[model samples]
Target: MSSDRLALITTDPAVLSGQAVIAGTRVPVSVVLDCLAAGMSPEEIVAEYLTLTSEGVQAAAVRGAAGP
Candidate 1:
Protein backbone atom coordinates (compact mmCIF):
# COMPACT_ATOMS: atom_id res chain seq x y z
CA MET A 1 0.00 0.00 0.00
CA SER A 2 1.08 3.59 -0.45
CA SER A 3 2.41 5.58 2.51
CA ASP A 4 -0.67 7.76 2.42
CA ARG A 5 -2.92 4.73 2.70
CA LEU A 6 -0.93 3.38 5.64
CA ALA A 7 -1.27 6.77 7.26
CA LEU A 8 -4.96 6.09 7.57
CA ILE A 9 -4.24 3.86 10.54
CA THR A 10 -3.46 5.55 13.83
CA THR A 11 -3.49 5.10 17.58
CA ASP A 12 -4.30 7.38 20.51
CA PRO A 13 -4.24 6.71 24.24
CA ALA A 14 -7.65 8.29 24.68
CA VAL A 15 -9.13 6.00 22.05
CA LEU A 16 -9.94 2.38 22.76
CA SER A 17 -7.06 2.35 25.29
CA GLY A 18 -4.60 3.15 22.49
CA GLN A 19 -5.52 0.30 20.19
CA ALA A 20 -4.75 1.03 16.56
CA VAL A 21 -7.76 2.53 14.78
CA ILE A 22 -8.72 4.25 11.57
CA ALA A 23 -7.42 7.79 11.68
CA GLY A 24 -9.99 10.27 13.01
CA THR A 25 -12.37 7.45 13.97
CA ARG A 26 -12.76 5.24 17.04
CA VAL A 27 -13.30 2.03 15.09
CA PRO A 28 -10.49 -0.31 16.06
CA VAL A 29 -8.34 -1.77 13.33
CA SER A 30 -8.83 -5.21 14.78
CA VAL A 31 -12.55 -4.92 14.28
CA VAL A 32 -11.97 -4.61 10.58
CA LEU A 33 -9.68 -7.62 10.59
CA ASP A 34 -12.16 -9.62 12.59
CA CYS A 35 -14.91 -8.84 10.14
CA LEU A 36 -12.72 -10.12 7.35
CA ALA A 37 -11.81 -13.20 9.33
CA ALA A 38 -15.47 -13.80 9.90
CA GLY A 39 -16.10 -13.95 6.16
CA MET A 40 -17.25 -10.38 5.69
CA SER A 41 -16.09 -8.73 2.49
CA PRO A 42 -14.41 -5.32 2.57
CA GLU A 43 -17.45 -3.81 0.90
CA GLU A 44 -19.67 -5.35 3.55
CA ILE A 45 -17.49 -3.97 6.31
CA VAL A 46 -17.60 -0.48 4.85
CA ALA A 47 -21.34 -0.76 4.50
CA GLU A 48 -21.65 -1.75 8.13
CA TYR A 49 -19.23 0.87 9.41
CA LEU A 50 -20.08 3.95 7.46
CA THR A 51 -17.16 5.92 8.88
CA LEU A 52 -14.55 3.62 7.36
CA THR A 53 -13.18 3.81 3.86
CA SER A 54 -11.96 0.99 1.64
CA GLU A 55 -8.43 2.33 1.90
CA GLY A 56 -8.61 2.49 5.65
CA VAL A 57 -9.84 -1.09 5.85
CA GLN A 58 -7.05 -2.30 3.60
CA ALA A 59 -4.52 -0.40 5.69
CA ALA A 60 -5.89 -1.94 8.85
CA ALA A 61 -5.56 -5.43 7.34
CA VAL A 62 -1.99 -4.71 6.37
CA ARG A 63 -1.16 -3.40 9.82
CA GLY A 64 -2.85 -6.32 11.50
CA ALA A 65 -0.79 -8.73 9.44
CA ALA A 66 2.44 -6.83 10.21
CA GLY A 67 2.21 -7.34 13.98
CA PRO A 68 3.32 -4.86 16.66
Candidate 2:
Protein backbone atom coordinates (compact mmCIF):
# COMPACT_ATOMS: atom_id res chain seq x y z
CA MET A 1 0.00 0.00 0.00
CA SER A 2 1.12 3.58 -0.57
CA SER A 3 1.64 6.36 1.93
CA ASP A 4 -1.45 7.91 0.45
CA ARG A 5 -3.43 4.96 1.74
CA LEU A 6 -1.76 5.39 5.12
CA ALA A 7 -3.38 8.80 5.25
CA LEU A 8 -6.40 7.02 6.73
CA ILE A 9 -4.93 7.77 10.12
CA THR A 10 -6.02 11.19 11.29
CA THR A 11 -6.06 13.34 14.38
CA ASP A 12 -8.50 15.98 15.58
CA PRO A 13 -8.67 17.62 19.01
CA ALA A 14 -12.37 16.82 19.18
CA VAL A 15 -11.63 13.15 18.57
CA LEU A 16 -10.11 10.96 21.23
CA SER A 17 -8.32 14.05 22.56
CA GLY A 18 -6.45 14.29 19.27
CA GLN A 19 -5.03 10.81 19.33
CA ALA A 20 -4.35 9.33 15.92
CA VAL A 21 -7.26 7.11 14.86
CA ILE A 22 -8.74 5.53 11.77
CA ALA A 23 -10.46 8.18 9.63
CA GLY A 24 -14.02 7.08 10.31
CA THR A 25 -13.82 5.39 13.71
CA ARG A 26 -12.99 6.20 17.33
CA VAL A 27 -10.47 3.34 17.50
CA PRO A 28 -7.05 4.65 18.51
CA VAL A 29 -4.00 3.94 16.39
CA SER A 30 -2.02 3.19 19.52
CA VAL A 31 -4.41 0.44 20.50
CA VAL A 32 -3.80 -1.21 17.17
CA LEU A 33 -0.07 -0.86 17.62
CA ASP A 34 -0.33 -2.37 21.06
CA CYS A 35 -2.18 -5.33 19.60
CA LEU A 36 0.59 -5.77 17.07
CA ALA A 37 3.19 -5.44 19.80
CA ALA A 38 1.38 -8.12 21.74
CA GLY A 39 1.61 -10.45 18.75
CA MET A 40 -1.70 -9.79 17.05
CA SER A 41 -1.54 -9.91 13.28
CA PRO A 42 -3.23 -7.26 11.14
CA GLU A 43 -5.84 -9.86 10.23
CA GLU A 44 -6.46 -10.60 13.87
CA ILE A 45 -6.68 -6.92 14.72
CA VAL A 46 -9.21 -6.33 12.00
CA ALA A 47 -11.19 -9.37 13.10
CA GLU A 48 -11.24 -8.03 16.64
CA TYR A 49 -12.21 -4.51 15.64
CA LEU A 50 -15.11 -4.82 13.25
CA THR A 51 -14.84 -1.18 12.21
CA LEU A 52 -11.16 -1.32 11.19
CA THR A 53 -9.69 -2.27 7.85
CA SER A 54 -6.42 -3.97 6.85
CA GLU A 55 -5.30 -0.78 5.12
CA GLY A 56 -6.09 1.23 8.21
CA VAL A 57 -4.02 -1.08 10.37
CA GLN A 58 -1.11 -0.88 7.96
CA ALA A 59 -1.38 2.89 7.93
CA ALA A 60 -1.56 3.06 11.69
CA ALA A 61 1.58 0.95 11.95
CA VAL A 62 3.43 3.25 9.62
CA ARG A 63 2.19 6.38 11.36
CA GLY A 64 2.88 5.01 14.83
CA ALA A 65 6.44 4.14 13.89
CA ALA A 66 6.92 7.61 12.42
CA GLY A 67 6.17 9.04 15.90
CA PRO A 68 4.52 12.30 17.04
- Listed per candidate, the RMSD to the true structure in angstroms reads 1.2, 1.2
Alpha-carbon deviation at 49 in model 2, angstroms: 0.6
User: In angstroms, how far off is 55's CA in candidate 1?
Assistant: 0.5
How well does each candidate superpose onto the true structure, as a TM-score? 0.89, 0.89
Residue-by-residue lDDT tens digits, candidate 2, 9-46: 88999999998899999999999999999999999999
Any idea how many clashes model 1 has? Answer: 0
Evaluated at residue 61, the lDDT of candidate 2 is 87
lDDT, model 1? 0.88
lDDT of each: 0.88, 0.90
Report how far off residue 11 is in candidate 2 (Å).
0.9
**Clash pairs, model 1 backbone:** none
Candidate 2: regions farther than 4 A off = none
